[model samples]
Target: MPNSTTPSSSQALEAVLARVDAGLDASLERLYALLRIRSISTDPAYAPECQRAADWLVGELSGLGFAAQARPTPGHPVVVAHGPDQAGPHVLFYAHYDVQPVDPLELWHSDPFEPQLRTDANGRQIIVARGASDDKGQMLTFIEACRAFKAATGGLPLKISLMLEGEEESGGVNLPPFMQANRDELAQADIALVCDTDMWDRQTPSITTMLRGLVADEIEITAAARDLHSGMFGNAARNPNQVLAEIIASLRAPDGSVTLPGFYDDVAELSPELKAQWQGLGFDEKQFLADAGLSLPAGEQGRSVLEMLWSRPTCEINGMIGGYTGEGFKTVIPAKASAKISFRLVSGMDPDKIRAAFRKHVEALVPSDCSVRFIPHGGSPAITVPADGDYLRKALSGLSAEWGKPAVITGSGGSIPVAGDFKRILGLDTLLIGFAHVDDQIHSPNEKYDLDSFHRGIRSWVHVLASLAE
Candidate 1:
């Protein structure tokens, strides 16, 4: 057993936070070094780069006095490390070392692999790179905090375990199996810490209390044996393009409601208390739409934009392909048309049920002598952490003290599958905290992480760890 004494001295925390502030430059250098590696997990061509990233982390953690190793998975490797044990809560910190592929390279002002320090329109100093804000910078915040703690106090305040995966940017096919196989070793933690979410705004910190689920499907409609000339068979032929369009059009009603039968059967309404709390966030829907080059809110008629994004279920046609349009205009009706569709699910919604309903709706629209095929993709259920738990209160208090404002407990419009998996497989509740802002532009060109966020994030973790230890 490790020492059970908790470090309750406010002066100790202050000293650690001061060390973090003083070591900010070295930390940025470390993050820049990691960001330079092209660890794109989706493309098999960069497998070696992914291994290099994992090895780099292993070296850094080992230098921090952690027993760390680069453990190989079927896909990219995972880096696991353990700090010297203390007798407080055993906590697991999770982050990804992989990043999304940067395409449309012309849109970036600088090379995606080169980390650059630039000032944004608002005069905020930011580090621009492909994965600067996504996971690299965010993950480094915790490591820097550990560094500061070790340097200031000579030890970590609690029992700490680190799990950094390299397949998060992809579908993470190897994660569930690995977690299942290593449950005994991995699940001994009291709670999981994740930094893959966004803050409420630029200056306000936030904790992601809920995450929407996802269901993806691809449908192909075949009308004729081959392409038919529009002039020759314009009226006689049933165009699969038109059929696919009509099927997509019929998915939602005029009120912006999904028409699929029982789509909302399992969905539950937000509690009045939760709704009140969301309303208090004072989200500006108009500003949000303006930033995206829009001027109106378009979802269910009555719900607020936040509710539509974070609470309500939605169906979106992600992509569609149909007839020909090469040079001038090919007057041909393609025999086969296809579309990719995805749904954002909330609590109580079953991904399987929603997928089945979508297929039924499409099959009913198929015309005579025409065939349709539904290709399933992936599905995951929504994740909800206990907002009233002791762990949450401790984290909230810690964040509030660091930022000088109460942390907003919010829901993400996006899905983090590992959050749900941690709960389902390891029976561990994950506390999702991050310093990324809405304008961070993650997974897009010109992605950046604010310098203030990088600095304050490390300090915030120092406080959170101290609170958890207490």
Candidate 2:
């Protein structure tokens, strides 16, 4: 068993914390250099930029005395770095180097690649760039923490393995195969740390213990062979648009329950204890909705917004197109209509089963004259780490000390596929801790990470590493 008591001297820990504070300017400069890479993995034109980012990380980690290399996958490369060999528990830290593409570039205040530090309306200093808050800024936090530890103690507190992927914002297509191929090297760690999630709020730290899985599908319905004028085909023709709309509309009942048969068979209910803990967090549903220009919560009825988002499964249509949707009106009944849909899965739900059930439901809804086609995008299972493990307790204590408030054990509605892969392929459990805020606007224009989050996040990792080293 791993040591449960905190290790390292108080003076040594304080020295590391002070070093982190003193190195903030250098850390920010390094982050700025990385942010300028334009490592957008989804676009083929930026492939070289992704490689550059991976190479940069390798150099940086090597400079810190890590045995680092940029290993190539079928897609973008992954950077693997090992810290000083130590005797205690080993930890594998994971973060991504790739960022979402910056579209609608007109909305950005500055070039997404040329990172800028600006003060928001609240006088909070923010680093603005495409990947500032999503993963770059968060990744740097752990690296900076390791740097501070090396500077203060002459080595890392514990054995550390760093895995930085370059294909997270885009689907992580190659990570699974890479993990399977290198399972022995990666799975030797006692625990894993993932730094790609959000804090509960600006002032409150959080550890995400649950992540919803995902299943994405694209559906196309075909009727007439070609587009037809609505006036000419009036009541005689079947409109694929109308049929697709009806199918989408039928997905949810009046109380917001999904209409797919056997959809709820595998969904597990939240334990009363867990529900009580969430209730104690003072989550303001109204404020959460109002921030997004909404009033009432829109999920399953009789459930709180937090429960609906974190625990329950959901089906949503991400995009739909059937008829003429240009600036001007064209009264035409299109030959085909299509919709992109995704399902947020909870634990115990099978992605394959959900896909089959959904296809059956859509087939039943399709008219005899129209045919439906289903194209699967991707699927991943939900991941839940034990909330009461020694490593988790250590993280909570360390984070609580750093933030001066207890860290909330929270659940993420979003999916982090690698976390599940770590469990399945590596036999490791991950602790999801990050410093990004809800208002960070990740994957959106004007994405930003608070200067405070960057600085304190480093210090927080220092604490966590020291505590885990015990």
Candidate 3:
């Protein structure tokens, strides 16, 4: 076990943190250089920019004493940089250089690519740009940490294998294949470090230990052979819309918990310690509900807001469509209704099992006159990091020392496909220490990153490397 009495280490990092603060202007300059690259992976036009972004990372990593290169992949290139792959516990640090597009350009107070250092309403300074927070701002936290370590100890203490992908925001299709082919090169590490998540509120630093997995399902409920006029067959004809509603209603109980059969069979309950930690959040129900313009809890009854959003499993309807009413009301009973639903599963809850349960629920809800067809979109199970792992504890201590605040262990409601890819392709666990804030608005307009988070995040990594090296 690593000692928590690293006052000297803390003092050393404090000095580096001050340096990071004084040199924050230069860091912003670097970020501006990256943000200027329009590396949107989803669109074909930004392909060259994507490669350019990878090249930029190669330069930065190489400057830090790593033999880094921009490796060509099937689509965009991956920047693989290494310092030492030898003895001490290895870590695969993951991030993405590619960003989302800036459409509806008229909405911006300033150009999206040209980063501006602005302050939010609460007087917190933020870096405003398209990719400022989504990743560029976030990933630099780790890179800056490495820089601080280099400045302090002359090198990064642990064996570091950095893998920054260009296609993470898009579906990560190329990443799994690459990991499959280079398992030895990538998965040699005991654990992976991912910086794609967010901080809990603004004051609380969190480590994402659990992420609910998902299974995308598209279901079409077919009733009559043709669209029926409500006046012609108001009482006799079966309505697919009604059938679809019945199917959705049957998915969960009145208490707001998912009712799919066997959905809870494999789910593991949150432990006492985790429960206490979540409770300590001192969550305000009104503020949380108000943030969404809501007044009621939508998940399982009697569970804390943290539990419902992070720990509990759920089945939600992403979309629904059937009939047409373009202008005024059209009094026609739709012939078919379709709904897309997904389940947020916990560890051990197989997507296959949840899929089967969902289908069975729909089948039971289907009327004798109608047939239902299902379209499988995608499926995956939940991820739970080993709470007792050695490196896990080190990371926790690292955050505590850097921020002078106890690190909060929490679960994510959203999912990252690469974490699952690491397990499926290379049998490795991921340590997610993300620095993005909830209000960063990553994929949307007006994206920003807190200046404090950007600067402190780097120092956090410095302490983390020291802990891991020990």
How many residue pairs clash in each candidate at the backbone level? Answer: 0, 0, 0
TM-score of each model, paired residue for residue: 0.94, 0.94, 0.94
Write the residue-wise lDDT of candidate 3 on 50-126 in tens digits.
99999999999999888899888889998998875445678889999888878778888899998888888999898
Best-fitting candidate, scored by lDDT: 2
Please state the error at residue 114 of candidate 3 in Å: 0.4
Predicted structure 3: lDDT: 0.83
| Pairs of residues clashing in candidate 1 | none
- Runs of candidate 2 with Cα error greater than 4 angstroms are 1-7, 228-233, 327-331
lDDT of 1 at 162: 95
lDDT of 2 by residue, 1-470 (tens): 43322235787789999999998999999999999999999999999999999999999999999999999999999999997778788999999999999998999999999999999999999999999998999999999999998887788888999999999888898999999999989989999999998889888999999999999999999999999999999789999989999999999999999989999998878888889999999999999899899998897999999998898999999999988999989999999999999999988888999999999999999999999999999999888888779999999999998999999999989899999899889999889999999889988899999999999999999999998887
What is the descending lDDT order?
2, 1, 3
Which pairs in model 2 have colliding backbones?
none
- Please give the CA lDDT of all the candidate structures: 0.91, 0.92, 0.83
Worst 10 residues of 3 by lDDT: 1-10
lDDT of 2: 0.92
Candidate 1: segments with Cα more than 4 A from true spot: 1-5, 102-108
